[model samples]
Target: MSNPAPAEAPTGAGTAPVPHRDTEEPAFPAAADRSQWRYRPRRAFWRSRVVRAVAVVTVLAICALFILGLVREQTGTEGFLVGLGLAVLPVPLLMAAFRWLDRVEPGPWKNLLFAFAWGAFAAALVAILANSFAVRWIATATADPDSADTLGATVIAPVVEESAKAAAILLLFLFRRKHFGGLVDGVVIAGFTATGFAFTENILYLGNAFGEDQEFGSTGLGSVTAATFFVRVVMSPFAHPLFTVLTGIGFGFAALAPRGKRLRRVLLPLAGLLLAMGLHAAWNGSATFGGPLAFYAVYGALMVPAFGLLTWLAVWSRQRELRTISGELPAYAAAGWLSPAEPTALSSMRARQVARAFAARTYGPAAARAVGEYESFATTLAFLRDRARRGTAGPDFPAREQELLHHLWQRREVASPALTYAARATGRVWAPPQYLDYDGYNPYRR
Candidate 1:
């Protein structure tokens, strides 16, 4: 240009060429579009094939030991079958309850699988062997087997069983930090672990009850098995989950604690475990205090109130999680990275379901799958941004954010339009005509 003497780049036979002026950058450059970036997945230290294989084998061995121990304790094949059938009745109900609590930010199935397996196998085996040994030793020392049984139930069993179950939660919390984010995560994991423990414990109690009934020539609902079923299965199926949930609350608090609050993080879970042990002791001692009537009294006076309080807290926490998601996502939308209606639509479970349905109806199963994946990634991004704002984000925050953003960008072609239709159908107002005209049609805006 300075050479102006460059003659403005001479024209060809049928073409005209002009001297180049200063080039302005595009508003959305290809380099800035992360969807085009080549993603090199990083290998996690603990996800090595060898480590996973070893973990699988270890869980299997523990499950085998638990099964063998249960058989030995039951003494009859028929009794075991009866216990198995009765004991499984409450599992589905309990699992569904926890799953409902986790609807706001559902954790990975793999994490739940590990929690359940640990509870069913490793925790159960440890509790059984430890409690049996301690009870036998106490009986021999006291020379009073009846008193030993009472002491074992009130003291040794609670300590051993709760500690074993808490171990599983702790392992998952430490290893699966991304999933162990808040109070609901803690509650759900603890619930499943306790459920597994309860399942094994129930089998033992019901089986033994069945054996006693058989020995006494009793049958039908009036039998010892019936009484045990009413007490354990009907009356107090939530007993184990209730106690263990305290420990879970502690872990949940720890998970939300800031990175610098090292002392709080360490103390909270221990406090919870101690509280669980205390509650367990109180419940077990109720029977000794005044027999079954004392059990019923405590159930009404203490346990029921505690359960209601926890249920309310879980529900409240779920609402808070939804609020966080709704509040944080609009910034990205304003920055031209998401559709205007995405934050509101994602905040409502109803809207999400509608979006998925609309996608499936309009664009087939693959599009519906993409919509689901988009919802999950968006939820995760919301949580990550919230953590960053609170100064609790991990070292890899930027990388994780970029990765999630890339995933959302890639799926936006299919998911964004579906979500827009869902929002309109769900009654959210569309963008004004002026705004729409100004923005034009940018399908990849997100």
Candidate 2:
């Protein structure tokens, strides 16, 4: 080699291989492109065969209980049918509504289903058993016939019943912190669980209404169902969700808290749970003590404001995420990793949504998915790099992060633009060339 460089091999007829030209890296590496946002779920989650099987059994058991309640009802087929219809009617919309409110990455279907199932099965059974036993025991012990009903109203109903509902949200948090994401997501998950519980519980009451009808005819049942439905579903479908959301908030905090501060994490969640319990108890007390009309006033006066505050907090968190992403991506652009065009496109929520739509139009849903995935990785990398620069991330972290960034960048270029090209070929509108290009030069230039 020292004797004349061993006659250096020729490059493309007197040209050298362009640096960064290996954009399509070996294996569609996860680092080369940061514009894509991957929805790839994390592996080794709590969901497993056992969890699935158990969840299936739990749902079946709930069905069986509902059937038994139906059989005992004097209204027979009509009552059962009505109950079933009512129970299922709001499910899809309710689910969609909650999902819309949730901005953080959604959790697995099974995890959500399980949380709801816990409410329908374990929570329901435990609440009934605990309440009935406690009520009877209170009556016997206190030797006042009114004691059981009094305690049930003042203590047992509020404490045990709400605790049972809160337990569903708690277990979801314990089993799956990554799914918790943040406060908005917490509210959505808890809301669904609460909805499930409310639906099942409604059937019981509806069945009772039907039975009362059997004794008093359709008029009686219709009156009961109408009045109850208007009060429960129409007026305040939010009660259970509001109560359970507190636990969800606690769960969100627990997931977000740093490790090693065990006391702080535990205390925060405890405080949230206490808040949920207090609100739940007060609602139940007001509704029970004041009758339906009084309950209406209390519900409007108190619950509406509380819920409004939660909604505002959710919007605030969303804005914070937008700001965080906006601030972080510019540094990545200055680095060689991202083209100037990309950070602008991704950090703006509107731009991001349009990009996704464009990807989908060009490459179909699959392309859109890849784009989203790449972006998510890019975001994580940006955060990692920032931490490293701040001395928060450890030494050598930047090197490792760069490796990942390279892979994602390559993947983004391939999957992402391929979609754009595909869209053009299919006669779909693609992003304007000027908009897609960067600074009158290709950022991917050598």
Candidate 3:
């Protein structure tokens, strides 16, 4: 298809002349004329983002200090050191897996970091205190500490811990709504939160186990420490993440629902929370119900299947996001906002990587960074338009669209040629016949 004709610049007093281009049309108005599209928030000093950020950081810092003190107190110095070392083994792997799933439209690291911190410190503190209080109350009322502990593990712990972890998801959903978009976003955030929770919990379990080993004078593979390591680290590092991801999927579907459908939005997440609690309860009760046989049965029959299904759903949803980008961006392409090949090229991760590599090789790292930013802006634009079409976008849709278009326009000179080259190299789309003649060809000219 032929490129769209450049839009005629509007004539008016005080307007700067639009710069001339030989090959491509400007996507929107000239940068100098976009004052109308800018958004400037007007808030009091106390309500400003900097103030709010400081407040949040302070609260989280306090929570971190308290939780660290509590864990260290219980584990003792030597046991705590051993537990910290062992518990950290699975964190990187889990974080990497969740991050890989988020490659299509990655959210800010700050959001993920906040989720992890919330889980590790705030959520853990809440679960420990609440669960301990409830169990003590139950034991006092029923005069049976053993049954109270059993009830706490099966019923109270699930409710408290899942709710605590879900608090991080809820906060992100309510406040950082932009980043908590779809299934994968929800899954990744929940995974991080749960990973953090598991990290702290593993330290406690492994530390207590080490203490038990010291008490029993055992120092080898057959000791309590080795068993705890095998069970918590190797056998089921994904346990907590699996449970929390159910709740995340619920929130994901809720995010996709229209704003007018309040009941559906609320009910979806509640249902997911209930499912998460049920699964968690079952897993916790497995030993009490039927020992190793029951634990293995639940792991094999329920957890494994659920994990596999969720993994498939997450992968399928990611692929669907790419398809959405390719499908939606062509309209902008036809309107001169993007080159004809970009929609297709941006749809493939391979092409995007190739584009960045080509830019780095041809024009240095800054150009590669520009190309990456262009891809991100383009993806955000596609999602915004899709949300608008579905009647789920917020009131700032027009302003946001303009902003994204401006960013894409700024980087297109460097990004476009690299993407075009990537498209050609990957055989996603061929160069136009007029541009194929090497005698007059200039790939970097746009």
Highest TM-score against the true fold, candidate: 3
Candidate 3 Cα outliers beyond 4 Å, as residue runs: 1-37, 431-435, 438-446
Candidate order by decreasing lDDT: 3, 1, 2
Task: Give candidate 1 regions above 4 Å deviation.
Answer: 1-50, 428-446
Candidate 3, residue 252: the lDDT equals 96
Error of 1 at 63 (Å): 3.6
Model 1, span 59-91: residue lDDT tens: 757785766566545557778788889999999
- lDDT (tens digit, per residue) of candidate 2 on 70-166: 4345346667667656656666776777776644344577777766776766676677678778988888888886857866876776677667777
The number of the candidate with the highest lDDT is 3
Compared with the true structure, all predictions reach lDDT values of 0.81, 0.61, 0.86
Order the candidate numbers by TM-score, best to worst. Answer: 3, 1, 2
lDDT of 2: 0.61
| Residue 162 C-alpha lDDT in model 1 | 96
Of the two candidates 1 and 2, the one with more favorable lDDT, higher being better, is 1
- Cα-based RMSD of candidate 3: 5.8
